[model samples]
Target chain A: MRHLLPRARRGPAFRAAALALALAAVPAAAQEGFGFGEPEAEAAAALPSAGPASGASVGGELSFSIDAFYRAEDEVADLPFEGLAEGVLEFKASGTKVEAFIKLKLSENILGESPEDMLDEAYLRLYLGPHSLEGGLLKLVWGKADSQGPLDVLNPFDLRDLRITETLERKIAEPMLHATFALGDFTKLELAFLPGFEGHRIAAEGPWAPAQVEALELLGIDFEGYLPDTEGLEYAQAGLRFTTSSGPVDWGLQYFYGRLPTPAVVFIPPVSLSLSYDPYHQLGLDAAAVFAGFNLRAEAAANLTEDLEGDDPEVYNPSLLWSLGFDRDLFGGINLNLQGSGSFRLAEEGVGEVAYDIEADTERTRTRVTAILSQKLRNETIEWELRALYGIEDADFYLLPRLAFDVGDAEIEIGAGIFGGDEEGELGQFAESSWARLLLSYEF
Target chain B: MKRLALLAAVLAAGAASLGAQGALGAEEIVRASRDRIQADTVSSRSRMMIVAKDGSATERLVDQYSLDAKEGKRTVIVFQKPASVAGTRFLTVSNPGRDDDRWIFLPSLAKVRRIAGSEGSGSFVGTDFSYDDISSSDREVEEDTHAILREEKLEGKDCWVIESRPKDPSFQYTRMVHWIEKGSCIALKAELYDKKGLLKLLEFSQFKEVQGRITPMATKLSNLQANTSTSIAVEILKYDEKIPAGVFTPRYLETGRPQ
Candidate 1:
């Protein structure tokens, strides 16, 4: 069980690509989370007599977006130009809901490698009272906020580069069951469970494997020839959130816990890969407040996990990780956001330190800072935003600038970004890269 | 008719002395109340409880509001209850000296229906209070002639009692007596009368301070004839945020979502 961690970490690109396809195929008609529009007093007027009975109400919204980018690299690795497109459809009836999503990668011209092109993300949802059942391929949201940390099920997209990160691409959707209950005026409780099954499970030797060894080549990560077959996995999560208002102060707090399965295979001599499953635990908290022209939001999460072997080891010990961030409005529509997070390995034999020497029990921390300026045109429908991010651990900086224009029923936007960092294998060699893209979306 | 003459004589005497001292004079009090009502338009989240004649009750969360004088044309946006009218956006535009123009955006039907002014006197959203009661933000000062009644203490708060008679016979209420807070100039209570001089509805509640402005944050309006009442509590008050002008447009109401 412990030996499969390296392999699981190797193949992120394939996973990311697959997740993207799935997201695109998702229908736009799915029920969005909570939303409230401005309220007005009812007119002091009488209504006319009732009309003929109409059938039950039904409606939905759809969105489609595509990203294209080109990169100039010294050695031109596997891919330099990539194109991605995604579409979503959502519908609701009798308060019941259904959604479908699809994601596709049209072309990738890199260092000359053409993989089997494909489709991703197909699922459906049904709501019965307090319970919602989901099937096919689906992304599950867990925790109070920031599903990215340890329980993220969806791939994270990089709009400027038209690419999704390799690290986050491996999250896949399986059949799941979810439920929500109103705790009170200011609070709600939700729970979800997912059971692992055959067709959904990735086999160690199948042509379409969960984690492909070849995909990890770019990251310089390699796993020993041992291929582990996973039997199944199970996940459960719960969250509670509450909101309250007193005078000008409005605020809320949320807490969540998720336990997710991590499947791996280990091949012993003369025997095919044997599947073993380990689960990871995640806990998170989120809080927000709005007053005057100011808004504040903050979130944090911690991941807990144990090595597959019950006994403690020394070299590559597992660790608990946490992340936190805050955002505030400066003036007009301008806002400032700052975030920092780090991971620390708990002291254990044969696990805590390997490649780098460390104190028997020590914590490693990474931090990042970002600043953004946003402005809303007084009488116009256009808005603009500029942002910059600096990563402390990697000593890298990224700049993102975007402009959005409202055009009747749709919104059109253009954006550009640049990233500068130290080159790989070289201590002080610096490098820089940039990309740009455009997007159009409509809501009904 | 003779009783009306006697009441008029008494009001004249009260006005003459009150005007001479200029201390909370009848005219001054009425002017202050009108000015306060016109100062700011408020958007509030209200929980409305409707009690029926049989003592049964229904509760709903209503997003109700009015734009301040600065907002120019009077506008109101009412959100429908989650169960019956979820996604319903209703808008009413009031024109001076004329009946307000009304439209209801039904999300279920995806259509905007204009409401005739004749229907304005009907109960609002199944509550005992008429829609007129809800949109009376700009009730003209001259529409009702005010006569300072007296100084009194009600519900542990000091108030000014004043009688107001509708200048227009078409107005639903014949006369209304208001309890106004001397400091905030907000009407803390009101008693409505029918054309026959019979008590009709009673409204009373103190103004709660929200975002530096004093407003009637909670109100209890009772219908004497129907033996029913509605109590509304407004929470989470925010002022002057960048709300899209489209949010107030008729198109937005019908869609239930802003563009």
Candidate 2:
């Protein structure tokens, strides 16, 4: 874990104060109270008693948004780590029959690497009588989980340039065809077909791959790039999701037959390693219900892969995952969400793999608890959010807190991320990755 | 025509038989108010201002398309705003005997999400209006028992003050009161009382005749306890507008047009 852990970027309180000052620089309107939601759009009018009838509108809406942010880090291990700058520009438009969206992200290291440009999403959608068909690059999300769910599988996420925390938006969109049909008033059926597969843009080679790779190397586990010859059309993917709501409850049943997002690194003795994404079938169920001002959601999935018996230590076994969560608003404009999730491996006992002890084989059942508390003020123009992820079984946790102020179309905020726990725990392994940042963005 | 004639006959006989004592039932008053402005289709755009107790105000722009369906009314609302809420759309289909079906498309999610029944009590995008509040205007007239409380003069016009109590004990509002213009039968004011007492007051004004149709162009909902208020000002309104047939479906929520 130590060798694979990404070194943390730390900074002094002075840097944090500087970021805070920058955040407070925005001028606020002289008003007493605030609320949240779409502030730009408004409605009201005095209708004409009688006048010429207005013609139907066949045109659409068009808008462009620009967002940029900078963050300063704290000192880590007596060394100064430069911060980062990020920028994104998006163009969107949707008519009665068509929809289009495109976005580009630019990332740069304050003291290091050059700016890198990424094409985030470029997609178009069409509405066809009770059915919707979308093609081009698409980001598809499934499941009703508050946080990440084992069932919310579709887009393989690439790490955010500034991966300070985890969010569902980390998804990487790829070319695919998505169709949704309304079975009736209360039900919907969705289908997705992928001509090709897109695996996670996870770590591969050298120094930038995080220090943890060295430990794996010490254990004779070496990782290689994707097999160039395996990029054939046979490796496609498809998925189906059926959703319905009755009374107070909403639920969805989904199925997907595709290769896993993360590849399993095959270990064949010293100085040898290769990567392969094992094909698997997954069955998922998700539901959400609101009661007493609280929204409760649950998601569960059973995966079938190569190693059902679990005896083959090298090949990962089938897995089972479940998540339960709730969201509610409390006094003082505060919203709180909490979730408990667990993952289990389905493997037969005594199925014999002697290379490593069962305890250290990395096949143990894991559980975690996560929470998000957010408060809004001045009508929702100013919001402060705190998120925490705790590994229940490993006793490790990570905390991220931020303050954001929305000035019309622009926003500014500064905050720090904290990580602590057992070195063996998931988040604890990145204890040193704690960093503080300031963000600013504008939409037009 | 038959229903109106029957209603007129009933009113005339009641006026004679119970001259001093009001004979108008709660259901009749409500039905009259609900049907005062009748059209096959309705389309309008308006500006809304939400004011906080401290006097701060925010504005929103929206367009609404309402079509009369066999079961009830189907309405689609699209936010045309400063930008934050732009491209957001909401569709609600009325169900006569049961609850309505509602769906929303948030620009942020880029997908349509079905709103569950439990969410009906929640606020409508941070506004004073709740999901239930918006649909309550078309709520089944029979769901509650209505009775005319008194006949009084309001603003120099004869008016019927009515009270209604829901058949369901667990309804959000314990009781409701309405001030309906006697001749026009248009509800000019309403008050909702919850368990804690007086909750809200909704007022309709800016009465105008559109193509022989009487329409209230403005509405203000005030939250008594919260000291917050929201007012809707209709900017462009037209009756019997030829709205695209597809506007009533969920596809219209996401694509802005129906197939």
Candidate 3:
């Protein structure tokens, strides 16, 4: 079924003159295949050198990027220049009932710290009738919302580069075992277990460094010394999710038990700082549906932390988090996506004693709105996009405008990120770090 | 065969003296043209070339699998070349009286996303063909009103010039004019008109027999307004293959496995 445009809504003419076309419908008896000459013959010869195999393939990509700060010098001087080179290799092999994939990445930051090489994901899947099992270091997304949804908390984030937002670029894969039981055509039950904990990574001494560190040091406190060890068995996590469809809406319910990915800071009575990871139980519900032409998604979660009664000074209080979003094409092929997310603490009486580097996490109630406007031109060979994030409570905002050109297997992207508003707010904390970047990549 | 009935009808009613019989003959001819090829499942690998107005060109490699299902027709298309889109897959399932259900899987996302059926007007992977054009082959003959415009020789063959106006007023095309070869009952050329007049010209060629079924192995669509065109030529094709039912599911779209 094709998605045909309503006749009355047809856009204006593509151009002026209507040229007569020469139809090439040669008689079958005389010509071999409606012979349209060499063009068609050339395309037929462009096929792969090798024929189809038993589904085993290897491919990779190589990329390089450079960032140039353009903010005022008076503001905290941002990094003069930052460059990165990355290479990725993927191997995939499949069988009738089993499949395996390995993705290896080698990333080198020329202007930063140590270069690292690692396996991004190496997983094996076993198909058993209507159920399947997967294991290895894996990365998974768990929410319906396109943006920051509370239910998508399965993996820790890589916050070292605050300018990145795409989940694929910002997520940190972890070791896990996952299983899915197909209950019906549109229903499934999933179980996931992570044997260890990996917290979000934040830069220690860069333009993107946490603002809380500076604030604590100004008060004569050594912030890093108080960080608690998180390598113990108690930090493991597990979750279960059930997804099904009702009418036109797809919905899911999930429950997870794990330690918070971000640590909470509290002040001790005797002039000391306490930083620790608190265990929590999260119950979430998510749904996605299309109404009219809009794709709508929503997610809500209640996180019950150790400070349920609001009596623990070093633990976080329980909170309710929610996100709602929708995406639709406005007109003339331009698309718009908007999302709003909020977190409301159930009992905030005990959390005021400490300050959070991330302003949204410290408030009793915090709300933020994100929007993305994008357009594709030249039959999708070129794309222009603008993304914005606003902190409703802190009066802070961040804007990112990008343009990309796709040339066969290569792509070139140019973009800039700007931050403004309350300097202490989550996004505004990097107000002086605004910069423009150029990225180029090619895949094979 | 349907082609024989079309020929018989046209011969019984003298071409120049026919009126209402001409319209019925047109519909029968169009139906016969579409029903000429029948298969339980069809699989093919093709190479497509997009030529720009400036004469520059790019190519893509693709694999397509199609089968008839209880719900309707089901298809899966996978991109193999042009690394930027490699590993991407799309699934579409026809739903009789309702809009088709569609989904896409982008390797970067590692998840499946449902696509709104209203995006039919959009280009297919930046090519000259629109999403609607991908499924046009399955459009029912009854969806449009047909009439024989005239009979003429097209490159040495006596062909019927037929005009078809969509029954749905909201269809993208205002009308489509076809040049069908008489003996084979195969549409060799089609002129698709938008509100502004001639919009795109489509030609089918490379007729071949696969598993006792006649099939068109090449297609070219040219956008007159933009002076650009895309040509797809089948490198390999097979009919009536046994494709597992699981290959059409969302799970298969995501995992690339027929589980």
Candidate 4:
């Protein structure tokens, strides 16, 4: 990975080129009609009352936005070992008949030796009276609860982090079909499906004796018997979500299942562990509530798997995770958010007894508390935000502070973080690392 | 003949009483309407329903606005509803005569855009309300002539009926009738006529005191010919904050985000 650095220097330049290409790809009509579905328009138009005699035509809305960040990390342990920069562009248009969205992301490794990966999303949506169909890379959210499993698109302030790992990896670019039927003002049924790749896959292979190689056996077990084959793997996930809002309270519940593929691996002799591919099952729950200026959210997920291979005797290991957070507006634009979560593996097994025993206590727990002081400097422009985060875990502690400035179509920020811990367990020695970063971004 | 004369006298007296105690006087009412039309700073949100003549409806959330008193200068922001735009923000500022300057800060985009403006009366966001309806916050009353039409009770509230005819042919509406509240000086209802003197739009609603000032709390605007309507419900209202003056500047319009 270190040898790939020299070529990575071109990452930013490539991203810039991609951005330019995307901009050029847009039609002239769209560029001219920017800010069509804006909040200001909604606020202005909503000032009027709803009276039976009033004859006002409902208005349409359109908007375009972009955000980017750059960072430099120093000597961070067990973290991405490279300087990072990321950019996201989004566009939306809404009318009485249709709504659409487009988004793209360009990420680069500044310090490492390889080109950064890029993620792009584009989708067109059509509203057909009672149903809607959207195609292209899109973020599909299912569920009604505010803070726990899904339906957390609103209220950015209550988010644990800007990025949610599970959802980010599940973002699919293929075309998807979705439909919704009104059950009532408080309940609706939603169904969606897409044709795409499954989460991950694993394969098996081995070398044997010349003539009888095909008939070889391992520890009285048939090497080729009952082995699963990997091909044309399809990933599918479906769930039912219900949402109801009464006064200031909103709630949601959902259930979903999908297969995940891990990287392929080779097993050695002494530890006789065969690399078998299997789908990991996940169950999740989420919820949130708001009262006055205080808000609370909680979510939990459990991973269930029974065996690594059918012929090989091995016990299944399961993991459970949960997170909780709270937020309050102290005054003005200043706000505070405190969040924490724990990831625990209930069972652990490996190729050898030594490996299995070592993995038994892999349960990890982490907590983070953050404070943000914000000010609306000039109406909607020139917003200044100062933020600080204190993160603590069983192995280490981290302190991070950042400041961001929004200037017209450009945004810039600078920040630094420090990680510290004493060497004790296997994870502690690696956790005693710290780094600082600076970021600058612009959008058009 | 005697009964007819008596009836005319009674109608005249009823009209007189409606005009005398209504919210705003005829001249003052016009002045307030003009003040809103020509307001240098205004911010509000609206829920719009686009209804086709065939009876099809598209409902959505629209954040409309304008900044600065200069002609062709304003800002407008729209939030995507049902998901993304629940708390989205947008802004627009008009440039001289070319087009109104515009910008939108999206949760997805997290930035803004400067859009060119064209045809003030063109459909706004595919709804019946034209760009003119959004920018109408600052029109001068002198641009139109005012006449007391009659007095009547609208939506169960006593109102003063007044008619206005545009002095400029370029004005989108040829005439507008307002039902001003006798006690609050607020326009409780209004009827807009096209150049041919045909009714084109109707507006009516109620007002609530916000921050010590009477302001429209709910309003509905319907395009009669188009057979569609836009409605607004204010979920939150705040006033007289120390909002920086620069927040309304074109530069600010291009970058402001809720902190």
The numbered model that scores best in lDDT is 3
TM-score of every model versus the real structure: 0.46, 0.73, 0.85, 0.47
Please identify which of the two predictions, 1 or 3, would achieve the higher DockQ against the true structure.
Answer: 3
Predicted chain A of model 4: TM-score relative to the true chain A? 0.58
Residue B104, candidate 1: Cα error in Å is 23
CA RMSD of all predictions: 18.2, 10.3, 12.5, 18.9
Interface RMSD of candidate 1, in Å, is 19.7
Per-candidate Cα lDDT values, in order, are 0.45, 0.63, 0.71, 0.43
DockQ of 1: 0.03
| Top-DockQ structure, candidate number | 3
Candidates ranked by DockQ: 3, 2, 4, 1
Q: Model 1 chain A, poorest ten-residue lDDT window?
A: A45-54
Ranking by TM-score: 3, 2, 4, 1
Q: Residue B152's C-alpha lDDT in candidate 4? A: 88
Per-residue lDDT, model 3, residue A62, is 93
Worst 10 residues of 3 chain B by lDDT: B1-10
Q: Which CAPRI category fits model 4?
A: incorrect
Compared with the true structure, what per-residue lDDT tens digits does model 4 show for residues A13-79? 4554455455445432211121222433433323433111111122212222232222224333434
For candidate 3, list the clashing residue pairs, or say none.
A3-B120
Tens digit of per-residue lDDT, candidate 1, span A16-45: 455544444443332322123222212211
Off by over 4 Å in 3: A1-56, A74-79, A110-112, A115-117, A217-225, A268-271, A349-361, B1-24, B167-170
Residue A381's C-alpha lDDT in candidate 2? 57
